[model samples]
Target: MQKQAKYIFLITFLIAGLVSQAQVKQDTLKREVEVTKAYTPTISDANKLNSMPEIDEEEADKPTFNYNIKSQPVFSTFSVTPLKAATIETTPPIQKGYGLVRAGLGTYYKPYGEIFFNNLNSKNTVFGIHAMHLSSFGDVKLKGGDKVDAPFMNNEVELFLKHTIQQSILSVDLTLNHDAFNYYGYPEDPVPAPLLEDEQSINYFGTKQAFTKGGVHIDLDDPGAEMDEEEFGFQLDYYYFGTKTEQRENFANLTFNMRRPLTSGVGLLDAGVEFAQVSNITLPADTAIGKTSSTILFAKPAWYIGDEKANVTLGLNAWFILQTDEETQAKLAPRINANWAPVEEILKIYAGIDGAFQHNHYSKIAYENPFVKPDHHLKNSMQQFRLYGGFDGKMSKRTTYKISGEYAINTDKPLYFMNENYYFDAAYNPAPLIVDNTFDVMYDDMNRLKLNAEILYASSKKMDLSLSVNYYSYKMDKQEEAWNLPTWDATLALGYKVTEQLSVSADIYLIGDRKALIIEESGSLIPEDLPIRKSFTLDPAFDLNLKGNYQLTNKFSVFAQLNNFGFQQYERWFGYPVQSFNALAGISYAF
Candidate 1:
């Protein structure tokens, strides 16, 4: 068996060696062959998959190996970018100082000063004090080239306090005013004075037109601006007005108003009432004339409908006006107002018909024209009816315009005229002076038609412009012409900023001619429609004003103003000529 295995192994080894040799010889030998056809390569079609793939559910064995990483900082040549930090909020802005002082001196011996004091930001309370003074002590050149002393002084002081309680606001105001002006008006042609009474004196006519006033006003309001709430308001006002001659007037008013919303706040019901009194206050108990006190009452009830885009107000005003002569005058008038905006923010139309009743208080007349005195009794004025229509709209992005017309029927319209002097000083209880150059007012029934147009433009940051024009036509019931009332008036104003620290402004004013009475005699029978007195037209008046301001520092500024630079000798009244070509320069300081 051993001998046979050895022989088989030997045979196998010999065969293997012979095969290897044969293969090497065949591969190493080079041979050439001729081909009848060229060789080509081709691929057979692949098998298609018809059924979708299915995932196996059988568990598979997972490898279990554990390794630990050494904690070390790896070295790298690449750079890393940093992230941005979070933001931080800043504080609120600082408030301005609470005091301002202004002082100036001007031509015509004018001295002007103003001061304001107020508290800084407060949570629930605000208080302020203001004082002002202006005066002119110089001569005015009349139309006939004559100079007269036309001195005037004005002073004002006011104090105000306001407080907030929950959602309501309460306010209180105290005001005082003292003013004086000399009645230096005289006709161009001097007229002869009639014989004086036993106790009359010419020097008394030189007394200044001086008056003093003090007032207190209080108000409480609940706007009810949030969440369909009711509104309520109250107002109380009282004042004392007096002249230098111990003649005085006292007035008091109390008002209450309430509003109730209806129909989900789409409409409102408004109701209010006012109680007022006017009394003549005189010392010594003997200078008083007629009734001392007069009462006035007003009841206002209205309904308001619609929203900001369109609205209508229907109301009635019941008035009870009493005269100083113990006469009662009562009237009930209708009030209606309708407003609509056809093109929101672009055009708005408003129309209204209303009437009002008010007392011709001595204080009101004195404030309107300090040079005028009353010749008749102080009565009540009534606007029987007033119809007005207007349209206001934005002309452009920075411009706005308004056009309006009004027609009114007025009774006891106050009109001023040159005093018809018959030297009737004896008729007055107090020894008085009589001057024909002085002015007096009368009451007349008038029908008036007025047309007005106004335009405004603003650049917000730099420039501003404004213009207004008015024309009036009057039909008087008893007078030959509307006395001392102009038929046309116009104003133009422009403001420009040259730089951040400098600004300039200009203004021009125009007034048309007015009529004056040219009567030679006077009597108690006045305000008649008869054409006994002749009439003449006064010259038109024009005025131009310029102003400049320069800011030197944040809290300091300088200002200069020029008034009546045209220097035209025209009268605002029949014979009174205003001062000409006045200039003022001043400095303002804030702290």
Candidate 2:
């Protein structure tokens, strides 16, 4: 009964809520709108415009490119400079000139001149001529305040010709030389005048030809044998002395050489022969100073073993010496030479052993020392052995070095000595007169040792340097010392290009101590000893030379030379002092 009542109450409540939520209704509210009447008007809405702005077409699209920029060096900024067209440089091309003439004057009344003509017949044949002259006429003051003039003059001329025929070459040379010198060794007031008849002249003529197998058109009968190349030459030398002293010499030589490859082709055979004749003639012949002649026949046969880069030659020199009233002498000397290239074209070593006979004559001696006595007895020098070794190598592309050493033994070697001949006239002269202010030859056995070194450096930028040194040791059998021979010598040369038209060079020369013999004067009278016994030593010497050249035009140039800048009064000879600081300037013209 209770449950039925609860359901009835729930049903009654639901019906009551439903009836209350669904029976309510509301009324609607309305608003009114007002309308206006349409009106028409006349047309006018456009406004006046100001003047149009002007347009700039040129500045419309401006470019941002740059035309001027600072130049930058391509190689290096701080060290290297950029190559560019120079504003102050206006150098012209240097044309080739064939002929040249040079002339100059310097202190001590010295004059120098040279002439060259090399443009003659420039076709297949070439011919040239050269001539030179130098003279000095001033007086030199001695240490004792005595002034004396030792005038000297030299003249030389040369003619050269070259012709090429097919594959062969032919050349000819002709030369003539003359010299004049005076022996003014004493004071001006007390010394007797010397004879001015001392003059020397020389003439030489030579012709040579180089012939190959093909050029000579040689036909071989045997196909296996090869025809050799040959060289032929002829030379004639004549020398004469014109003065109170009469001396003349004539030398003729004929040279022939032939070389051929061996059958194996690994070696070559070389053969050569030289025939020479020497004649000495003197006018008003005295037994002690008469005409004398000699003949020499030399034959050398060698074999070359190795390739072109490295080779060893084994040979012998056979000489036949024939002299007047003397037994014939036959000399046999061995000749050997070896060369090897440890590095091709870069380093090379060479060694050789050779011997020869040197002829001594009046003309040869006078040519070396014009003060030599004209009346000289000629003799021959025999070189028994000479051994030498050297090595040359390139340190860099522009630098090279060479060092060499040598040992030699000689017999009958000629040494220079001051003459002891003098005359004194008590009536005409106050001082003694030296008949000959010259050097005489003395024969002795000698041994020598030598060492030499050289270095050369050259750059592509117009600069070069060369240095050399030589050391020598000599021992004599009969003499106290090797007269006038230096123990050490050195030289340095440097060249630099200042500009396209200018160049300069510097040279340095050094000489070590040398020994010499001088005749002693005992109270204004020369001694009557058979030979001079007094001797002295010469101190070391140093010399500096500077030279420069400036080219004004292609065919004209100016040059200058400065010598002995150190101002050292060094004696080159026993009594003759070298020139002091001197300068020479000259002009050269070429056409």
Candidate 3:
């Protein structure tokens, strides 16, 4: 078998080399012809100028004329329009289309086990599979995990379609996901213990609870016990816009666009309304534990005042949201933005007051409590308002800067993870502890402040650099409970155009330390101190392209490409690795 495989590989390599050579020869011939034609000259004046003569004072002094009629070659009397290159009749290439198919197989390694399992160790040799298809119509992507004990099966499928009409456009999207895979404990193993004291204990044998100290032994014979959860959804959008042109006007827009140009040098006018709906189906522990559906309707009308060099936008928005089996919340939001362009093309400044209200059933304790009676009940509503302002613009041809700040207010009862009843003392007071879930007029509001800044600089041909910093702090009514959370992220990208056909790039990302502080209500001397954890990661990548045409005949040619080099590991989330490095070189024959 090994000998046979070697022979096959050799044959494939030879074929690819032959094809590449042929393509290069054809491309050379074509380029040579283009160069020669570009330098070729017309012969119309050669004979006429020669016949007109060399030392005649009258001819030298007077304007030269082509008196040699034969040299003119009897030019056509009828006028002729040059034939254009047929315009190619190319489509927009389908903004979201697909034309290529990619598939790769690789190895993955990661540390895994129970969250706090002592046997946690890194596992290698995990297989990885990736498949992608892109075309002018749509795209498809598929990936799978390689090893056992992986978090989930990691499957996702999405579809998108767009259609255009005379003055309207429509888009549709669909997605399906199934990402629930975890370890199942054995009968002799201890049941998983609750992370929180008030949480109920679960049996170890059941797939729902994988870890526990002690529990009644239950048979793990159920077939559905190990099944993973599934979720899916779909979305659609339709947009329509029309325009009317007027003399001297800069531009006119008719749509749900909030900004419109004016005939005068003044700023623009903006107004629009947006509606969105989402439905999620969740099955936890093989049971329909949670499901949420919501619809939101909102509209914003804004105006840009002042000249183009300086302007301000004042807008108002109102939102109403309704959740199935949950509460209905409403909000009125407002925004203000200012823009200053000191140097029309070089520098600009911007600032704004962007505020919004968020209301949802999950903000209430009744909806958060999993063990509550009539699980879907309206209990309380939490409202959050944010005021933000920012400025972003170019500092030079290759540098840009952005700075922003935000202040937020969170009102109503504290947002707790578990149901409210679980936190109450059922033994001391049984009658379903009832308390108004309202923000205390005196001191129940939560205040948060955040400041952020980013800078990007690019060199003429080789390097791109970026840096950013974020600072956040929360001030609640309780002083000791208040905490500060700050995060800093930075990245640098460098690309070298080694040659006309080969290029390479290096990218690095850094994340600063992040700490989460939580105060538990334990009837003890003081709250237990939990250790803060930090994580770091690094990744890098490269690409190569060899493009040309190979002539099979005078009327036929083949084009090929050698793409994606080094196949480095790229990941956006922890524990989830992306496709491995692989080469995709294919040839297409054109006639």
Candidate 4:
């Protein structure tokens, strides 16, 4: 009886609620109709008679049926005024402009400062400065019996400046850069044992070791060793070829570009010229030991078509390079690149061809000879060419795939000697042995082919994943001295958004079978004798962003970067040990 009563009660309550809802809806509709009628005009007899006097008799006779149709007036007491036809004068489309300036000062294990500036006006310009000071000193172990003591130092500065200008149909850019590095050591010391070992070993694969013999090793507590080495060496050791070495380099570049619209369906025509200069100064043991300079001039003309949806460009480039105290070379290079969209906007295919001839002087520093008296001025020149093509497309809203392949070749030319009859006899000989023309010495040539493919999936809200694979093969011309260094590299990353304010990311990189052969001038090639230094590394980082009304803050972040995480001590070359697990953590804030 009670249950039945409860059921009846619930049914009655639901019915009453529905009835109330229906009454409210009907009242709202009635109010809207009444408001509409209040502003409508009624067709009274007087108004009809007045309107009829102006109508023609034929029109009146055609509508003689006793029918009455009325509609509400569109304008009421609270109505907006009718707008006049406005002559909208649009300001001619002014191009957008933007600028950015950023500066950062941080103390890592060392002190670091950075400044960056960018201008996005009619012309784009960018400039940056980076300076760092290390508070602690480190040691750089060398081969043979030499060692270099690198004390924790300060006052290291590097600067870069760039400017770009854009006109209606032309653009110009310029860049300047300077770099300086400081290291501590003494002159006349035997090459460090570690470095000497590296020089002698065919492959770098081993643990790092320190050499204990040969040069004078001064204790850090020695008052003389603590003085600024540059000034101390210049003042004290003015006779024995000085006691330190310093290197400085200056670089500058300029580029000019012009574009012209074409009448045909083809894209615009483009031409450009580039100039670059590099000056390297090396001071050793008190005096300027060597200086090398290089200058290059290059020009390119190209034709381009289509838009971002699809594009094809063909171009030819020519360059002339001249090096001080070296031979000059002229090169002609051509390039072609294209992107095709076959199905409107779904799939994209791309291909490119690049080829160039490069020539440069062999470094005499490696042989410890002065610039004026190079052991052998080797005319080392090569022709390099590559062809690459790829396809990228979306399979769905959340998945994408890309695949590419490249083939490159490097071929050497005949050698030319500056001195025809130079011979090798002394340790510091300025010439190489002149052998008979029939003496067949195989030059170095390489052919490489690479293939890469990647797939990205972002189907979930909280997680995104990507997988990629790369394959490479390097082949040499001389069979006995040839090397087949086939490598496969892969990477995987996973990220988690812990909260709106913080996130963490972890990634791993794996390399496989990074082995090769090392050949010597003695006509003997060592195989598998060099260490195959391949390993997997992990990088995990976290970031926190604390929001404020008019400021942003990140309190603390940590990163653990592990190289050769497997703890395998192998070197890409002999005697030089690769870095082990190195980790750093810091906190940053900005206003």
**TM-score, per-candidate, Cα-based:** 0.76, 0.71, 0.44, 0.48
lDDT of 2 by residue, 176-199 (tens): 666665554421123233332233
RMSD, one per candidate, in order: 39.1, 41.9, 28.0, 32.4
Candidate 1: where is the Cα deviation over 4 Å?
Answer: 1-95, 191-205, 223-229, 264-291, 374-376, 421-435, 522-532
lDDT of 4 by residue, 466-541 (tens): 6666777767675432222325556554434444334333434444443322222332256545423222221221
Worst 10 residues of 4 by lDDT: 231-240
* Tens-digit lDDT string for candidate 3 (96-134): 111222222212221111000011121211111112221
Worst 10 residues of 3 by lDDT: 25-34
Error of 3 at 99 (Å): 1.8
- For lDDT, the strongest prediction is 1
lDDT of 1 by residue, 144-250 (tens): 56567788888889997766666566778899999887766765544224322333244333456688999998877644343234555567788888787556677
Clashes of 2: 1
Q: Alpha-carbon error at 187 in model 2, in Å?
A: 12
Computed on alpha carbons, the lDDT of every model, listed in order, comes to 0.60, 0.53, 0.31, 0.34
- Model 1 is weakest, by summed lDDT over 10 consecutive residues, at 41-50
- Looking at candidate 2, the ten consecutive residues that score lowest on lDDT are 41-50
Q: What stretches of model 3 exceed 4 Å from their correct place?
A: 1-98, 109-148, 163-170, 177-295, 321-330, 359-387, 412-445, 458-461, 478-485, 517-591
